[model samples]
Target: MSGHGFHVHGPHDHELEHAASGGGHGDGHGHADGGAASLSGGMSMTSKIAVCTAVIATVGAIFSYMGGSTQANAGLYKNNAAIKKTEASNQWNYFQSKSTKQALAEFARDTATDDVRMQGWQVKLARYEQEKTDIQAAAKKLEAEASQWDAQSEEQMHQHHRWAQATTVLQVSIALAAIALLTKKKWLERAMFGVAAGGLVVGALAAFHI
Candidate 1:
């Protein structure tokens, strides 16, 4: 084609030339060249999208692992809390038993006519009181420990929630990649990759529990 024709066609060089002159006399060669170029472009795009999808899938897997781990830890903490609470209840019951013994000892001392027997009953009552005090302290310590564990577990589970959100984004990105591949839209592919980046950000935050 002439300079005027080239000027009218745009800067796409060979492609513009082909369209301008309809491949001239070598129409077969021209069409073949165009087809080859189109195939190469398609292959490049497909490879890119496939790689993007694979990366997204990997991120999703990591997020899944974190979520599962955190949830398991949370459950373990809750179990420990329950066990501590039971122990605390048992301690309180023991305290009540000690109080009963103390009351019985007091009554026996009050009724005893013999000085030696009365002194022994009084000593037993004091021992019971000391034991009850010790038991109460231990029960309180156990309850405190249980509460700390429960809070830690809850924090871990909260991190798990963040991981879940990241995983969801990664999955959505994969789906977008699928649609982009089917539609053969480069812009859509780019958008899908952007989503994947966002997923990665969220995943990192989850991993760090931030």
Candidate 2:
């Protein structure tokens, strides 16, 4: 066909060109969509890992703090028990004074007063002994519990450290893989995947130990 004094293409030619252009544009759009989807998935996975790491770190910190507090309490109780025992001994010494009987008589002038003072001193001595025993028992129990907590906290800390290390390696591998994905470097991607797999294995073994 001819139009405007020039040879013109038929409708089939124009349709062919349109179809070719449309196919190219569709393929490009598909590639873009795939890339976007891949990026979204990667970001989702990264965010999940970050959240998990934060939780682990927080738990480790809490356990560490609790262990420290338990140890401190154990020490305090032991010191208090020592102090109480010393005070009880001093009070007993006062009962051995040369004027002990005269002093007691003066302090308790009436029958009721004498009985009350004697009973009060006896009660004080008994209560002090009981308190000392209780403190010792409590200190021992706290010490044992603190030891257990310390062991647990140490194990957890070790696990967290291992995980942090493993995560670092995994992050590096992922970064490399991302670069590979961008550059179409199949070998680099494969290498990164292998490294990531090793990191996962190591992390699993470390967790088992913990």
Candidate 3:
């Protein structure tokens, strides 16, 4: 009455005020319930997806590192194989030199007129033959070592491939996770888990050197 107009109360005015107050409170409660439901349902899915994505990312990183390590090992083993091959080649060359020396010594012994000179040539021939034998043995040994290193390098390369495959699958899983988060599709989440499991299996294969 003081502000604008006279105020009047009907017989039902108190009930109407009470009803309005209750409706307001009910509307607030409904909104709170809706928020809680969203938290428990949608937010719950989001949290699970986030956690799984994080775990998958960590596993993918490990797989990537293992791939790199295996690749490095393969390269190192290949270098070792090359080094051994070079050593074998050197030994073979040394053996060839000894063979040439032995041939010359034999010729000298056969053609020599003096007995003392013949004896000296014979001694030289025997020494050269023994040296050739030793060098041949060393060369064969180095060749065998090179073969072993080559085999090891091949194994490492295979393992590197496995790790790379595992990492790639995990990366796909991470991509699916991002898509699921964006689209809120349960099917995408399932696919993400399946891909992630496949990635883990590949990683296991790599670990066992399969």
Candidate 4:
């Protein structure tokens, strides 16, 4: 106690104050380090997710392109089949015209009274028969070609379907990855990887034409 009514702090009071200040500074440093570590971890996870999503999107684009190409090929092949079928029909109609002319020539030859007239009619009938044979052979060949084009069209359509399937699966995987990033769930990340791998397998099947 002082005459002026002011009391100075003792050694025990000073020691207690210093200890309290030191403890507060230490606790602040600890909290700062923990926050920095958490921020670093979050940034790293965000980078990983961004990179993976980019790769998946690229793969899906490739699949979509392949599907388009196959579908276009199918259309072209189908058009070829139609053209061949039309040609076959034209040849068949020509053969029928030749057959009608050959029947009329035979009847003329059978009812002819003069030898010279009958001989001329016989020549005409033989020519008509040979022409009919050639026309029939051409028609059969055209029909066979049309059938082959139809088969090729079917095969291209099937390949297009396979590419479509692969693209769809990869899209689903990308969706899953986005969900995992938003929710920060480890199990969702695992599911995303599994689905992406399955999409790749389906893409392989499409490449091999299976």
* lDDT for 55 (candidate 1): 76
Model 1 global lDDT (CA atoms, 0 to 1): 0.88
lDDT of 4 by residue, 1-210 (tens): 798899899998887887787954687778999999999998787778778889989999999999999999999999999999999999999999999999999999999999999999999999999999999999999999999999988988898998899899889988988898899887887888888888899989989988
Best by lDDT: 3
Instruction: Flag clash pairs in model 1.
Output: none
What TM-score, over all chains together, does every model reach? 0.79, 0.41, 0.86, 0.81
lDDT of 2 by residue, 1-210 (tens): 355677777898887887887954777789999999999976765554445445444544443454455445555555555555555455445434423544454445444446667777655555555555555565555555555555555565566566655666666666665666566556775676677666666566555764
What's the true lDDT of residue 90 in model 2? Answer: 51
The pairs that clash in candidate 4 are: none
* After superposition, candidate 3 runs with Cα above 4 Å error: 1-35
Candidate 4, TM-score vs. the true structure? Answer: 0.81
Q: Find the 10 residues in a row with the least total lDDT in model 2.
A: 94-103
Candidate 1 ranges beyond 4 A from true positions: 1-34
lDDT of 3: 0.93
Pick the winner on lDDT between candidates 2 and 3.
3
Clashes of 4: 0
Q: Report how far residue 199 has shifted in candidate 1, in Å.
A: 1.7
Each model's C-alpha lDDT?
A: 0.88, 0.58, 0.93, 0.91
